[model samples]
Structures are given as structure tokens and as C-alpha cells.
Target: MEFNFGWEMLLLFFAAAALAGFIDSIAGGGGLIGIPVLLLSGLPPINALATNKVQGMAGSFTASMTMIKKGVVDFNKIWFAAFMSFIGATLGTICVHYIDVSVLDILVPIVLIMIGLYFLLVPNIGDVEKKPRMQEKLFNTTVVPGIGFYDGIFGPGTGSFFSLSNIALRGQQIITATGNAKVFNFASNIAAVVVFVVSGKVVWLVGGVMIIGQILGAYLGSLMVIKNGSKLIRPLVVVMCFLMVARYLYGKF
Candidate 1:
């Protein structure tokens, strides 16, 4: 598809994608920047979403690879979760064509607020790994798929959900959970990108430019997560969750 984006608009999108990648690599809500920027550049909502997926995939892949190379992600433990998440996202994408997601418009913001508050109030929740309250099998089968479905259906805080579940249920340290979260996030993103590609909605030129920014931003953000650990991730997670809540509320009302 041909787009008439001015040079200034292109630069704005590049900057936005960079910022989105940085935030998403840390806490996941990159769409907040990506989708809006695409819309502002005059694309329709569906095209914007599809194009955002392309850029988001770039960011997620970069972050996931960085975490893996840094030895922060445990591939053996996350393989099952990643597979389940991919399947769940594919199903969710199919379901979106038939189901009314407006129900989530109200529910998701409430859930996001609660999640943000939970992290904010609990001073030391994700500071260190704890004993598992939920088994790996249960978490992989239930929590992983559920969050993946949510990402496919109505994505905003998927990363935060994954990280929180890993910490609260599976006894993973904050940094470790964030790293593992990227694995599943990448899987789900790939699933979404496939659907978008088939539908022919992706704007390759714009996506290509944004991807360059995504790569650089994702690399830097992953490094921060590796070095700062929970000290950096916790606050960012909380902030992103609240931002998601505000974005949803704005969209709804």
C-alpha cells in the first residue's frame, strides 16, 4: 500500500518506535506508542494494528534474543510455555473475527489497575525468587495460555501479566520472569504477524523503518533489564500498567 507520510512524520514514527521498543522490552505496552503513531500518520485502525505487529515482532525478537544470549532466559523451562502461548494466540486471533472484544474494554482496565496496585503496594514481591505456589505444569497450561490469548485478543499488558504470574505463582525472580516473558511474547507476536501478513495489511516501508528503531531500543532496554534487574523493572511495570489503564479508559469513554 502506498502511504504519503511526510519526512517529519516518518521521523516522528521512528522516534516513537524507538521509545516503544525500549519500554516494551522492559515492560510490554509498546503498542501505546506504535499504534497511535501509525494512526496519526493517517493509516486506518486495522492497517495500523497490522503494521504495529510487524514492528512489535522486530522489538520482541530482538529482546528475546538478547535475553537468551545473556543467559537470563531458561529455554528448557520456557519452551512449553512458548509453544502454548503461540497456540493460544493463534486461536485468539481466529476468535477475534467472531467474538465481541468490547467486553474486555471495561474489564481490562480494571484488571490493569489492580495489577498496578498489587505491585505498588507489595514492597518486596518480585525482588527475589520465592517458593512456587503453583506448579510448572499448571502455570504453563493455564496462565501462559490465558495471557497469550489476551495478547491476541486485546493486548496491552501481556508482559506485565507474564512477569507477575511467574513471580507470584512460579517463584521466579523478577529479572528471570521478564526474560522468560520475552520468549512467550515473541512467540505470540510471531503468531499475530502471520495473520497480519496473510491479510496483507502490513505497511512494509513504514514497518521497515520502525524496525530499525525497535532493534536498537530493544537492545538497550534488554541491557538495562539485565543490569538493573528488579530495581528497574518493578517501577516500569507499575507505570506501564497504569498507562494501559488510562489508555483503555480513554478509548472506552
Candidate 2:
């Protein structure tokens, strides 16, 4: 594939990146918008995914920083999870380079739809403050690591999956859950970006522009979530889930 980014394409992608960054930081549907725009921009699938991760790193970093500053995360406890997520992401990237993403494309949407359906069916799910079902160490070590691996592998609905799992299985408050999710998502993206850069898959100029848009949008999304509450997050998650379903279905046909 010829690697050239026209100004018009750059501008259009920047807009999409901003929207994806904002929506993804808040509700985890950024890839739904970002990846499609990238594919439409005339890049191959792998290149698009690689470049998207580069931009996503920026958004995740900004959101993670904001959430940390706001005291929405437990840094000490989450550091281990972050490390594991990075490792998992690196492994995922290598696997993607070698394997086919089509199978994952089919599986991911099923998982996302199930998660979204659960959220939709349960009344006041995020509102309830409940104790964790699993022990903290076990959940962090086993549950979080497993999710991190999936995130590294597939790269969609990661934030929502992390948040929902934290809330449902770990029984964390919504704010803290989102904050920690950002931290891990940052790690996952960093790992993917490292792989992409090493493999020469990313278009730095294009990725850089997308990163700028992602940063601004992520900042705004963090602000909005802090101002609003789980009430806002729930609906957005549903929408993102629907979008994921659509993306997967389109890919199949």
C-alpha cells in the first residue's frame, strides 16, 4: 500500500478521531468511529488498526491523567494490573501480526452484545454500591489480567468491558472503575503502539495529527463524565455496544 496522507483526508480523519476519542474515553466506542474512517481513508486493515492504536494511546493517556488527578483511581493497587495489561497487549500485538483478525471480529461483538444486554436488563446496575464477589488480590491478578489480554487482542469496547467487570465482579464504584479502566487501557495502547512502531506499521505524521485530536477530545470526555455520572455512562455504553455490533456485522458481510 502506498503510504501518503492528503490534507483533506487528514482533516476528515482528525474530526473522526476527535469524536472517537471523546466517545471512547467516556463510553468505549472510539474504535467504532476511528477504525471505519481509517479504512475508508484507503489504508489496509492492519495499517489502520496499528495507526488507530497510536492515536488511542494519546486519548487513553490524557484521560488516565485526568482521572488520576481527580482521585478517581487507586494507583498503588492498579499498578500491577497496568503492568500485566502492557504485557498482555504486547503479546496480543504479536499474535495479531501472525494470525487473522476475522475470527476475533466475529467473537468480539458477541461478547460486547452480551455485556450491553446485561447492562440494559439490569436496573440501576451502576448505581448500586456493592462489595466485590471475589477477593481483591484474586480479582486483580486473574480477572483483570484476563480482560487486559482480550483488550490487547481485539481493541474495542475495552473500557466498557473493564468498567462493567469492575462494577459487576469486583464491586467497585463507577468512578473508580472508569479511572482504573483508563489506566489499564493506557497500558494496553502503549504496548500496541510499541509493536506498531517497531514493525513500521504506523504512519507517524497521520498518527500525530490524530493524537492531537484525541487528546483534546479525551480531555473533554473526562470533564463531561466527571460533571455527569453513571446515568450518562450507561446510555453511552449501550450506544457503543450497538455500534460494535454494527461494525462486526458489516465486516462479516
Candidate 3:
């Protein structure tokens, strides 16, 4: 198929990428924005999804670097999780062609609503240090692969999922969770994007431009989150989760 994107679509792509990157870097629902924007821009369903993956990877990569420099993450410890995430993502990407995630679309909103409410009402939920129930090795081996599989299957709130799981289940601090989540997210994205690219499902020209916006926006978001600390990131996460819930509901029914 011949590829073509007009000026209006180009503008929207950049705008969506910037906004999604900002939201994603801070709270992790950027796909909810970027994906729909691509769909509305007139790309086919598969192409839109693939294009979004391409652009989204740029944002994830940028945030991962920024958080690493800030000492918010320890890659050496999370390497196992990251590797598992890649495998999960590859599996998910392969399944995307065969399975429809319509049921997951219905479930995401309900899950997000609960998550959003928790963040909104509970202060210091993720700020405090706590003991983990599972050993690090076990959690990394099990939970990371589990979440990565889900991410590949239905990827709306992967970042938030990772963050909350790490804190609630593994007893990591919020900043650390978010930072570690980005690494896993990047791994997942890399796997998915490769599948899309190999299948010729991306609009490289448009995706390339969108990636520029995503990179800049991600950098800004990382800076903002770092400056404000968990206090600011918490509320944004709540709002974005709620938005994801609404969007998922709208898409499903």
C-alpha cells in the first residue's frame, strides 16, 4: 500500500504524541491518547496500532534514560524483569493478530476507576517504604513476566500496573517503581514495534515525526515528575487512570 499523510494529520500526530508522552511519562496512559489520535487520522486499524507503538517507544526510551540518571532505578536488579517483559511482549504481539482484546477493553475502565480512587483518596500510598512479601528473585521472575504478558495482550495501563504492583506486592518506593516500570515498558514496546515493523504495519514518516514530539515531551515530563516528586505524579496518575477507564468503556460499548 502507498503511504500518505496530509498536513492536518501531521499536525495532530505531533500534538497527540506530545500530550500522550507528557501524560505517559508522568502517569502511563499515553497510548489512550496517541492510539485514538492515529485512528482518527485515518490510518487503518492495524497500521494505527503499529504506528502508535513506534512513536510510543521513543517516549519510553527517553523516560528510562532520565530516570536512570536521576538514580530512581537500578537496572542491574530489574534486568530479569526487563528480559521477561520482552518475551511477554513478543508473545502478545504475535497473539494480537489472532485474539481480540474486547473483553479487556471492558475491564480496563473498572480497574482504572479503582486505581484512580485509591490514588485520589489515599495520601502517601506509594511514598513509604515497606517490606515485600516475595523475594526479589521470585517477584522478578513471576510478576514481571505476568505483567509483560498482559502488556503485550492489552497495553493501556502497563506502566501504572507495574508501578502499583512493585509497590504493593514487592514493597518498592513509588519513584523506584515508576523508574523500573519504564525499563520494562521500553522492553515491551521494543518487541511490539519490531513485530509491527516487520509486518509493514507502520507509517514510518509520520511515526518518525511523532517520535520527535514524544521524546521532547517525555523529557519534560521526567523533569517535572522529578521536581515535584511523588506528590505531583500521584494525582496525574489518578486522573489518567480515570481517563483510561472512560476511554476503554467508550471504545467497548
Candidate 4:
């Protein structure tokens, strides 16, 4: 399909990317906004998904770096998780090139909805740090890699999953978990973007335009996370997760 790179279209998409980056920087599920905006702009589904990765990588990188500079994330502790996430995402992206994603269409939304409900119903779930129930190594190997693989293959609610895992299993404070989530999200996004770039699926013009907005939005959102802490992030995470569920279920039925 052919697309017109008009100023009007660019502005619309840039606005959408900015909003997506803001929400994604805090709690994930940015694709719920970005991909739909791309589709509405007349791109084919595959192209929309591929192009979304470019802007997503920009947003995640911006947020991750912002958190790092703010001293919210400790790279020494998270480097292993980040590396595992990158590897998992790479493998998942390769699998996507060969396999149908329809199966995940049903499964992923269910999981996201469940996660949303968990956060919504549980009181003070991530407000403060608690004693970890699982070993850090186990978390890096299992939860981190598994979520990274899911992010690469499915590409939504990854931030929520990462934050929830850190809070529930690793006993991290909500703000700290959100910071760490960005790191993993950035890793997975880079892996997916590389695959999309190699496959010639990215629309560089559109992606490049949206990336400017993504960077700005991500920086602002990261600041919000630092300022508002869990009070802001928790509700956003729950909302984003449910929004992802609705988006996917609508696509399915």
C-alpha cells in the first residue's frame, strides 16, 4: 500500500507517538496507542507494527536513560536482566518471522487482563519494598527472560509485566520497579527494531518523525514517575493493561 507523507499525517502521528511514549514510559502498553494510530493512518498491519517498533525504541531508550540519570535504576544490578531480555527478544523476533502470531492474540490479552485485575484488587501491592520470595538469579533467568521473549513476540504490556514481576517477586518499590522496567523494555525494543530494520519493514520517514515526539514525551513521563511515584504509575499500569486487553480482544472478535 502506498502512503502519502503529508504534513497533516506527520502531525497526527507525532501527536499519537508523544502520548504513547508518555504512557509507555511510566507503565508500558504504548503500542495500544501507537499501533492503532499507524493503522488509522493507512499503513498495512505488518508495516504499522514494524514502524511502531522504531518509535517505541526511541521512547523506551529515552525513558530508560532518564531514569538512569535520575539515579532510579542501578545498572550493576539490572545488567544481567537487560542482557537476558535482549537475547530473549532476539529469539522471539526470529520466531515471529517464521510463525503465526494468532495464537498469542488470544493468550496475551487474557494474561494482561489478569495482571490488571491483580494490581487493581490488591491493596498496596507495590507501594513499598518487601522481602524477596525468589532468588535474584532465578528472577533474571525466568521472569525477566520470559517477559522479554513475550515483549518481542507480542509487543504490549511489557512494562506492566516487568514492573509487576519486580514488585511481586523481587520486593522492589513501585518507582524502582518502573525504572527497571524501562531498562528491560528498551532492550526488547532494540532487539525487535533490529529485526524489523533488517527485514526492510520500517517506514523510516514516519518512524523518524514520531521519534522526536517520543523522546520528548518519554522525558516528561520519566520525570512524572520520579515526582509522583506509585500514586501515578499504578493507576496508569492498570489502565494500560485493561486497554491492551480491550484492543486485542476487539481485534480478535
Q: What is the lDDT of residue 63 in candidate 3?
A: 95
Model 2 TM-score?
0.92
Q: List all candidate RMSDs to the true structure.
A: 1.1, 2.0, 1.7, 1.5
**What local lDDT score does residue 89 receive in model 4, on the 0 to 100 scale?**
91
Backbone clashes in each candidate structure, one number apiece?
0, 0, 1, 0
Can you rank all candidates by TM-score, best first?
A: 1, 4, 3, 2
Residue 182 displacement in candidate 1 (angstroms): 1.1
Candidate 3: which pairs clash? 109-245
Q: For each candidate, what is the lDDT?
A: 0.88, 0.82, 0.85, 0.89
Candidate with the larger lDDT of 3 and 4: 4
lDDT tens digits, residues 1-253, model 4? Answer: 4567889999988999999899999888888889989998888888998999899899999999999999999988899999999988988877877888888877888889889998889999878889998999999998888888887787777888899899989999999999999999899788888878988888888999899989999999999999999889888888988888887778768
What tens digits encode model 1's per-residue C-alpha lDDT throughout 1-253? 6787777877888889999999999988898899988997889898999999999889999999999999999787689999999988988888988999988877888888888998889988778789999989999999899889988887788888888888889989888899999889999877789989998999888888899989989999999999998888888888999998888788867
lDDT of 1: 0.88
* Model 2 weakest lDDT span, ten residues long: 93-102
Best-fitting candidate, scored by TM-score: 1
What local lDDT does model 1 show for residue 238? 87
Candidate 1 vs candidate 2, TM-score winner: 1
Q: How far is candidate 2 from the true structure (C-alpha RMSD, Å)?
A: 2.0
Which should have the higher TM-score, number 3 or number 4?
Answer: 4
Model 1, residue pairs in steric clash: none
